[model samples]
Target: MTTYPKQALLLALAAATVAAGLTATAAPAVARPAATAVPRLDWKPCATPGGPAAQECAVLPVPLDYDDPDGRQIHVAVSRVLSDRPAARRGTLAVIPGGPGGSGVQRLAQKGAALQRELAGAYDLVAFDPRGVGASTTARCGLAPEDRYLTSLRSWPGPDGEITDNTARSRRTAEACARNGGPELRSFTTANQVRDLDRLREALGERRLSAWGTSYGAYVAAQYAQKFPRRTDRWVLDSTGDPDPQRVARGWLANMSRGADERFPDFAAWAAHPDRDRDGLRLAARPEEVEPLVVALAARLDREPRPSTTPGVPLTGNGLRQAVQNALYGDTAFPGLARLVTTAQDPAGTPALPPELAQPLRDEDAAVMIGVICNDAAWPHASADAYRSAVRKDRARYPLTAGMPVNVLPCSFWKTAPEDAPTRITDRGPSNILMVQSRRDPATPLFGALEMREALGGRARMVTVEQGGHGLYLGNGNACGDRAVTDFLTTGRRPTEDTHCAN
Candidate 1:
């Protein structure tokens, strides 16, 4: 799983740009001859299944740090699928995967087919794993196996809002990372990712690169555009995030409070519907009753966490809330949460977390989530007390998330400060950017994505999908929103102003 600060910042910025229409030049031309004249990309087999098409994999060398260009170099994993129809081809467009830890290689596997199908071979689709990711110069924080659990890693509070245990745990986790995470762990900053992207563009031999960045990748794409405005072609940012420069990931974490509140209604309405009849999972007769039921159940769990299917792993109230939040990303996962809730409420039935929850996370995934935020910016130290106070307030205001949204994480106890300063995105980028977002996202809330849009200034136009959940484009099935982005990328046409996509 990936953390969402960058996503929120990018999404928020995209929303505002779409609303303002400050940079739009023309309504994209559907029959542009430029799209047809671009060269084809050569595809190669990737180390991973979902990476590039079977024929396009290569290693691009980059500096460990841009300031030390001649220093020890690292390799970034890259892949591409060339445009099959040159008559319809545009330019090369890189796909930026989400997760401060998400794999560009994996994203290509999952979304590549859809993109190829949609754009009519308008551009060669390309992607790469940032350094310290799969096939790249990987990093390991050497976290303890127990600390690797999702619940523990996220820094949930104790049963009764106690901070003593959480603080100690956080410190211990931080210490382990400091001790085990070597140079590679320290190297996982968004700034570094942006630099790596520029290097990738150079290696691809493209003078001006087009890109589609999703979630956290959007921040990277935005940063790259800002850094090299003249080098950018058409750019698309999907499911963006808050661009709160000071807070960065911290702000993204805090926004979860409002995000959960905004999106829970959709879940509640689903859980209460007559369709729940066959599953016997409905929590309430009316949609309004769902909120109270969830809150009360979580409170009960807080007092007495239930024994879970996994040994030594109990389902605490916060854990339940976390599971719910993750489920809200897409409609398919709703049933899993609904099942867990039903089983938890019923005495005879057994509650089981999804396999991803029950099993320990991969070391790489843990390191990504841990290393990125801590490396991106500094977090307060020993912030358990602050977290408790905030969580309590958040619980009252956003019952869907309980108090977990405002809780502390290992970053608070991280042993070191950021190696470099956070990169400030300025309006120094090309005006060839388009953004798409959902109006009510559970992770990257609309308000936060707005801040990012404001920061982008005249560089972008945003398309807001009047929908819910995390990702917006193909992920949300919003035709208008998806078309707006696809059209922009394939033909460089943007809405004159911010536009909305109806459900």
Candidate 2:
């Protein structure tokens, strides 16, 4: 999930900008032709608290709808930390953030120091909040508080793995978005994000842009490369999912089942380790026993819900399951999950709910998450019976996820069809693209990344890190994987072929 403080920072920056009289500009009546000159950005000193003091910020105005450039306009918050050694600067490197909900401005702040040290003054680091995200133009679906919690929004099935509540919630969410999201929410999409990136390129006066895109950002990067091949320079796609145009978001969701299974063993081994005994976190004596212990604990919770630290919000079977899924994203989160599981299993102990489960997401946050996924593609019009059957099958096969991966979501009940067909990624782009992936990412697994590699074909080379986690480069990735990506970005050189990085 996207960090709440980062989201708040973006919103705070937007408010600060408005207070300083930097208002959004109105688009002209006649749509400007693509060949027309793009407006230059007005950069100023705008840094977030505890962020890099050197960071500069600006708001770029782009049409709310690219198809109607003369139509309503919205401001996209952009930030940059220039290369200290300008004499050695190659070009701008855009740090695209993951999440249909991630704030790019915040990502730049988080990774700025590490990137500067790694690249050795090769480029200026830049990033931006997409239309409906962060400090960018905002929109809301005004969803009810109960429906805005992560567990509700994620479509976890009932105690018996039934999806009856899922269908009803899906319909309610879709309706709320359609009723209150307005045009700005409708504008949140992959294609528009690609168009907005081009606008950023034009505004920055760069003929080409190099980028580091991770997870969902990888999908946007791939789309940008495909649409504007010559405009790309040294593209890096980290931990990508399949870019199947037809399946799009649906395919990404379904792939989570495999991802969860692939990542579970790593967590199991950690939880059952001899060292965990000293920490008082051992789940079982053997790695194999950990899975059954968890499964049985969940079943027991389903029968009799345990009270959590939060009032009126008890820990249910699905709550533990959701916590497991989130924890699998990175190894650093393993100990917390182990502790939660241990607490829940104790009859006298109360499990403290994770922040995501304890509180309802901000309405705008929920809007962006649902808006991007649903607007990306058309979901199958599956009936209640279909969802129930799928849930039963998935739960039987992938107990770790508890069938949530394949269950119905708001996309199933989305009122509007996609504005445009999903972009089909191909090898037609420049061969400067390099991909780095983990062998067992809980969110974007190896198999899906391989599919993305296959789709890119001759245009891309991949480095598979023999590690288990969600993100690669600069995060959970091994030293070998990190060095390969750093080498590619700083020197414009790639491995001769797809390579593996031993843990």
Candidate 3:
């Protein structure tokens, strides 16, 4: 799967549009009467099991098209666990999730305990599935199971970096989605997701909402803040993407090129360390040698695919490298890659797909990965040519990725033109935004996050952790950065300027 960044420039651009009276969002069109009362909600029991006892679930009705509010309506499944310490409660903080297909209900369950502990009942934790996702009204393209595999879903280029096959697959996938997905699929754009979030805010009757968004979710939170700045209290965007509207998700995928380059050194160092002998997975005697060794291994795999534990499938060098990149995002995944590398080098035995890599991806997972990119923006139909160029150049510059960073995907063949145009983010509303990022993230690079910081103008300050990984805050063990974010969320305080966290 691919990862993207978060940025603030989107807010600035969005604000300019609001001031021009070109369009207005966030605030409801109906003005409030004098002596307005604080909104109250009637909480009911939620549907998900193992959720907090106080958690409530509700189905929120939203327009399939805001301009056509009277048209078809969709149900956005929402959940919330109210503050246990009611007196200490500040306001509500929505945990906007990453994948267009990711279930917010599940996100709340996963992060709920930690968030409740850290924030100390300071805010109600809320989450929701975007329209056309789980528990919400959904759309299906009826894609075949084989086409849903991780490698297939991502549109990895052919053995020689040729994308001719990728082109056909992209076209086929796009056509299937278009033919079967119906109106729901058309409503899956970033703009629609932003609008749905606003509707959720209205339903909750909150004047403002704090948020902690990670990975792709970071962009959604940033977009919401841009569209409704006054409605945002303290916004924390973790693991951001470039705010270049023209590129959007396309740029996010391309960013893997630089991200891989920045993060590979860490792996190389780890693999080359003398201590590696203790683990027996060392590939090189020196850190610098690890890169070339990996590159050569991948080339050898490309020239000769070997039988794997899965009968019909072989672990191509690209597959091995992909597993490596995904594993590098966290320390827990390291052994799987080490095992694969060790097994591959064994002359007496053939390697198998690591258990983590063995199980085929679920359709929902594939849907989210493919849908987000296809829905966010339009990719080049000549994406194959682009991939060819990217892989050839990326392979030379960052061989650890072996041209995979520049590979084509379903977006190239996605039959639908973007159902909606990309939203222009302006610095239109409240300046209550905080962004945190790792210095050396493999998926969303630091340089790209900076572009987002630059875009936010004076509306935001960034906290940079001089660490490595795809996620920050709770994902990494950086107390300094995590504390800074928690402080802002709980107390409305922020650093006077952009700050850095030490290793």
Candidate 4:
């Protein structure tokens, strides 16, 4: 379910640097060593067209591989909007974006105005695109268009729960990445991103910084807090996943089955509501009937695929299933899913494919996503027999997901193994982190957020909002939930105990 922006501005660097044939300076093994001397950034007007007029952009040169610090170099694109009132400014608040491939600069443009209004001039808003993202240095896997489709990349099992096609696709994808993705792709790890952020801290010339990290970014922020305990202030982890180093992304993908099942009820209730009748979006007479109707519709589509608005691309059962998973993320998406469902069930209706499914993803976006997970941790290269058995069980247990969450991925055939282990999130950091997670998030559910909470222990206080969505603050229209996080950020006040915003 992790997707990247398709049309982000790809600003051109004056020159993408390449350091040739020199042995990198190795750091001391006693403590975390500096990757390389932080490069001084020359800030200028950002090239991203839609960003705030006040925002400034910069390029940061980081080692292609930290262990080979002086070797090849790549640029990380960063942006910042200074405090409107310098006299009232407290410090810098870094905005960490989600998706191993999410763009921080773009997010700043989208949220910068609200963030400025929310905090007044308390702090400067700063963000950056991690390696292999946005205007930063990028790599491509040279994957064929078919392999880049959203459905192909998501590892959805074939018809009748068969995974032969998925298995072949996985191998093909990994092979493509290995053949075309060089050291640039291999360096896209969560650990490296943490390192890059620290280097950014040095460039900003700050001893400490506050942060608001969402989704996968939360993991990076947490890791930063763990690695440089004294450097972080007032950290916010919104909609984070489990930090179990052993499972990592694999555990995250596997858990989505349960998450989807939990959040589907919200969609069902919405779809069955009388309010939807006016819009011709109501799917069933009762919430209980919605699930069966969706399930049956998907099964029927498996037998006779429906033509979509996208030429040559038909809506299959898995397409319906993916739509269900995507819709559960937020209420804003419910109408689309309802409409798509109605369209599929209608004899003369033609379905419109979601933008994500309309075409292939950019190679760099796919590279970063696949690289981070594959290079961060190892995946099981289980036999086809083993996979078939597991997929059968997961499908039976969580039919809405249709075993896609637990199916094979390119990680199973990734070229490079992780040089270091995944960072195990622990409670050994300053007690300034506040976590806000929805009670039922399809992407990062309550069960997983609890795992992050437990891992952080005394260092964090969690606010569970009684809402349904992927993000908590600024996501669901839950004022109480938003206020809780805002109060903590603006005034350093918390509920004193892990509490729930039942309203």
Of the candidates shown, which would achieve the greatest TM-score relative to the real structure? 2
- For model 1, residues 346-398, the per-residue Cα lDDT tens digits are 87765786554565555655676678888888887645567778877776777
lDDT of each: 0.71, 0.81, 0.69, 0.78
Give the RMSD in angstroms, all C-alphas superposed, for model 3: 7.8
TM-score, cand. 2: 0.93
Sorting all predicted structures by lDDT, with the top scorer first, yields: 2, 4, 1, 3
Name the runs in model 3 displaced over 4 angstroms: 1-54, 309-311, 348-356, 383-387
| Candidate 2 error regions (>4 Å) | 1-37
What C-alpha lDDT does candidate 3 achieve relative to the native structure?
0.69
Error in Å for residue 82 of model 4: 1.1
By summed lDDT, which 10 consecutive residues of candidate 4 come out lowest? Answer: 12-21
lDDT string, candidate 3, 249-312, tens digits:
7787678777878887887788888888888888888899877777777778777866788877
Model 4 lDDT per residue over 169-258, tens place: 899889999999988888888899998898888889989999998877888898899989999989999888888999987887888888
Q: What's each prediction's clash count?
A: 31, 0, 22, 0
TM-score of each: 0.88, 0.93, 0.86, 0.92
Ranking by TM-score: 2, 4, 1, 3
Error of 4 at 250 (Å): 0.4
The TM-score that candidate 3 achieves is: 0.86
